[model samples]
Target chain A: MTSVRQRLVPYWLLAPGLIWLIVFFVIPMYYMGELSLKTGSIDTGYQLTWAFSNYTDAISQYSTQFFRAFYYAGVATLLCLLIGYPLAYAIAFKAGRWKNLMLFAVVAPFFTTYLIRTIAWKTILDDSSPVVSFLKTIHLVPQDGRVLATSAAVIAGLTYNFLPFMVLPLFAALERVDIRLLEAGKDLYASATQTFLRITLPITMPGIVAGVLLTFIPASGDYVNATFLGGTNQAMIGNVIQSKYLVVRDYSEAAALSFTLMAIILVALIVYIKFAGTEALMGDEEEAE
Target chain B: MEGSSDLPPTDPESDQPGETAGNTARSGSGGVRLEGVTKKFGDFAAVHDMDLDIADGEFFTMLGPSGCGKTTTLRMIAGFEQPTTGKVLIDGSDVAGLPAYKRPTNTVFQSYALFPHMTLEENVGFGLKRQKVPKAEIKKRVAGELERVGLSREAKRKPNQLSGGQQQRVALARALVNLPKVLLLDEPLGALDLKLRKGLQVQLKEIQRDVGITFVYVTHDQEEALTMSDRIAVMNEGMIEQCADPETVYDRPSTTFVAGFIGVSNLMPAVAKGPGEIEIADGPTVPTADAAQFSSGEKCFAVVRPEKLTVSLPENAPGDQPGIDGIVESSLYLGTSTQMAIKVADDVNMTVLVPNASEDARQHLPGGGAKVRLNWLPEHMHLVAESDPGGSDADQTSTDQVTEGVNS
Candidate 1:
């Protein structure tokens, strides 16, 4: 009886966290899923009459916004990778005594609210701001052109806001790569660039995958940056869902839109993971084997 | 250095006595030379001014304890580390500023740093692929090298899939596939269990013999160095204490550091009384062939291996011969041999090894606190200079199994 009780101790320890998840996640998710299938206005109250047509309606009305959300998120994820990778790589391998300070700087923007930071970008890219005037003088942007209320502004904001998410995982992964492997590559007659491509890059693939997932997932559902920086033409699925739920009081459509966005993300993640190779995702366990 | 460059490295002239007397200068391909090489890490000198010439196809080992600069020396030769001052020559050409990729040398790292993502064949063919070898030829040679290391079946498997010893074999095959002018190994078997390490030692030596590539292996394991190296350079501090064939190094170590570091040395403070006679630390007068080298009244150490000392009951000892009388402090029965610690004096102790010829013989050996007499032949007693303070404390904690049996 004591031995059985000893085995039960671990479950007992885990019960609180499990209870919280079931209460908060499972219950709410089930209710929202049912709401996604109901058909009614807020004044009439929603009724779950197996009204699956809300999904079709949500998809048809918000298809362009859905595509735009994913497009901006994809571009932002790519930009984060381009900027975060080198920044993280420098911190991991080259920063020496300054590494901790550089890493702290990467996360410093989080001290300010993210919405405020996005608004700060709006001020920085205002039409009369020096950045826009400089771009005009360089003829990169026409004199009449504006940086705010554009898709570029939204994408840039998403990249900036989610960059730390990309950097931290990449840093963790790149830091785990054995220095001896790089030396071995050089010893085997690989040039510097070849060594980076053949050894350093492949070994840090898990970090890249993790960074992309962390950046892409939240960026796709982000509503604040689109509302503040993007015009109506640049509005995304997140904007539609937000306005539908809070402004138009269409809870069913909002829930349907949320479920569709989640489903699209899940499918896209599976496809991305497939092309990038799942072996790197299981890197630590594979190495232990 | 004594061997001519044109001769195939297997020529008998290569291992002739005194070939490593620092006399011969290499003229052409198939050798590496370090001329006054010194590596300093800021204020610390890791490798002092070192001059060494490794002959073509010879298995040379840089044997030392940790922090003794053997790995640093290997790194300088591989061009992974630049010498603080002086030149490193490969095939008689000064490769002063060359990088590792450009150097005609490859290193098998201690960790067996195989690319975890690459298959065995891809790993073994990496150097060839770097040189852009034709695809079919790369595949063929990769297969051939894999078979050479007895890993042909593991060609498609990733490095992580293989066992530790198997991964080591892959590392070996990968390095050998490059056909480098010199192969450097940095304690490659340091991670394996003892039984596996011993097995790999013989295989690694045989592979070196078969390939005829000048192998510069660094290891702190003295027995491994002795068994595998054609010549071993015993290092202390940042300098080479002694460099010679294994037998010569074991039998006639040039310094106190070499004697103690290579194996367990029972060093007794003694005075040279006359030729073939020496008086131990206020104890009995002993005989040694090396006593002739020292003048009477000069201080030296009478060094002898534990196996050389014969332990016997007082009654059974030779009647007239003088020997140190000690009480057995401890006795350990190793399968093939027996080890006993004998307390010769309050502050002095000596270890003795006796082969277990029969169960009766081991049973008859003295146990704790039993009186015993110790003696050895005059030729077995080596008179070394007094221990230098700088070298005494370094290798005490190093894990060299001195009781595994000395080469001598």
Candidate 2:
């Protein structure tokens, strides 16, 4: 009896999380799937009519927004990686006694509300602001060009908002690297750049994959940055979904769009994992052991 | 200086007997030389004003307790660390501005530091690949090196898949594949269990002989150093206390630190009276071999090895021999010998080791709380300089402090 109880212990331990996922995730997903296949409007009572055209209609109508959303999020994720990698490396290896202080500074923006922080960028990038004037002087922006409400502002906002997600995982991976391995690389006739490429970069690959997923997934589905910092030209699929659900009250169209976005993301993630290798994710678990 | 010269010719096939001498001034002889090398980290000096020469194909060991600057000295040779104000010469050429990647030296780290992401073959072939050796040549050499270390079957395995001893062997192959002029090993077998360490010690010595490369090894284990080294440089407090062959280092330690650090020695506080005599503190005046080296009334230690002294009942002690009377406090039976702790003076405790040849010998041995007399020949007592600060007590407490400093 005791042996049997011991075998069931893992299931018992997993009970709470399994229950939470079933209630919050699986049930909502089922309703959303049903709602996507219905013929629905606010004035007329909604009915599940198995209308699969709702998905095709939503995709055809807002294909431009879908493309814009993916493009902006992809560019933002790349920018975050380029900026955050060095910052994380510095904090992990070179900060010395100042490591904790620098890490705190990286996370300090979290103390303020996310919406407020995005609005603050609006003022900083205004046409009359010093930032725009400096950019104008440097010829980065033309004398008449303004930064606010453009694609640049929306992309910059997404990059800044999701940067910490990139940095923290990279920092964790870099910190776990034994410093002796770097020294060994040098001893084995590898130049500093070669060591970074062959040793440090490969060891920290799991962190890169995780950071990309964390930043890209939410940024693609986000409407706030586009609503505040972008004009109609910069609006993404998120904005279309918001307008369909709230302004137009086209429930079936909104549900269809949401399902389409999720399915696309799933397929993209599968292809990515296939290319990058599932071993990268498994590497993190081996390190823990 | 005397210790090094007195060493028996280690390699009978070698041409010169004095080739291992540190002061020979044979520069550019395809070996390593450190002249006035000192390393200071802020206000703390890790190594200070060290001058050493390791001959080509000689297995030299830097043996010391922790925090004794052996690793720092090895790092300077490997070009991982630049000396504050000295030159590091390898194969007769000054390598001051050169980085480690360009230096003709490789190091086996204490932790084995194998690339976790790469297979065993990839890890061993890393240096050759960096040197741009041809692809076929890399594969051939990597396979040969792995087979040499008995790890060829596991070439496809990552480092985490192998055992610790196997990982250590892979680390050795990784460095040796480069065929460096000088190979620096920082306690490579330190993490292994005792039995495994002993086996690897013999294997490492054989490998050194086969390769004929200048091997500069660093370790805290005295037995390992004595077993493998052609000559051992015993260091303490950022400096070398003595450098000599294993026999000379064990039998004739020049300083109190070397005597205590290398083996268990009874350093009884004594005052030199005149030629061939010294008065032990609160004990008898005994005959010493090197009393002429000290002035009259000079303070020193009457150093004697534990196995040199024979213990017997006070009544059965020899009448003609000069000896000390003490009370045996305890006797512990070691596998091959019985060790007795005898109190000679009010404060001085001496250790005596008696061989357990047979059951009859064991029956004749003294037990705890028995009055006894310890006897040894006049030549067994060696007079050494007074123990210097931070050099005297080679006990567990100081060992712990040194271990902590090195780890931190």
In order, what DockQ does each candidate have? 0.68, 0.59
Candidate 1 lDDT, B242-347, residue by residue in tens: 8999998888887777878877767677888988889998589876778788898998877778888899998899765557888999888778888888988775
**Model 2 alpha-carbon drift over 4 Å, by segment:** A1-12, A284-289, B1-29, B395-408
What's candidate 2's i-RMS value? 2.1
Candidate 1 off by > 4 Å: A284-287, B1-29, B274-276, B319-322, B387-389, B394-408
Q: Candidate 2: lDDT of A226?
A: 91
Error of 2 at B9 (Å): 32
Candidate 1 lDDT (Cα, 0 to 1): 0.85
lDDT of 2 by residue, B1-408 (tens): 222211222444432212221222222225899999999989888998999988998999999888989999999988888999888999999999899999988899999999999999999999999999999988987887776676666899888877778889899989988788888999999998776787678778877777778899999988789999999999888898889999888888887787777767577888999998899888888877689989999988877788999888988998777688899987877767787889998867787778899989898788888889988888787877855756546544333432342343
**Candidate 1 backbone collisions, by pair:** none
Cα lDDT, model 1, residue A103: 95
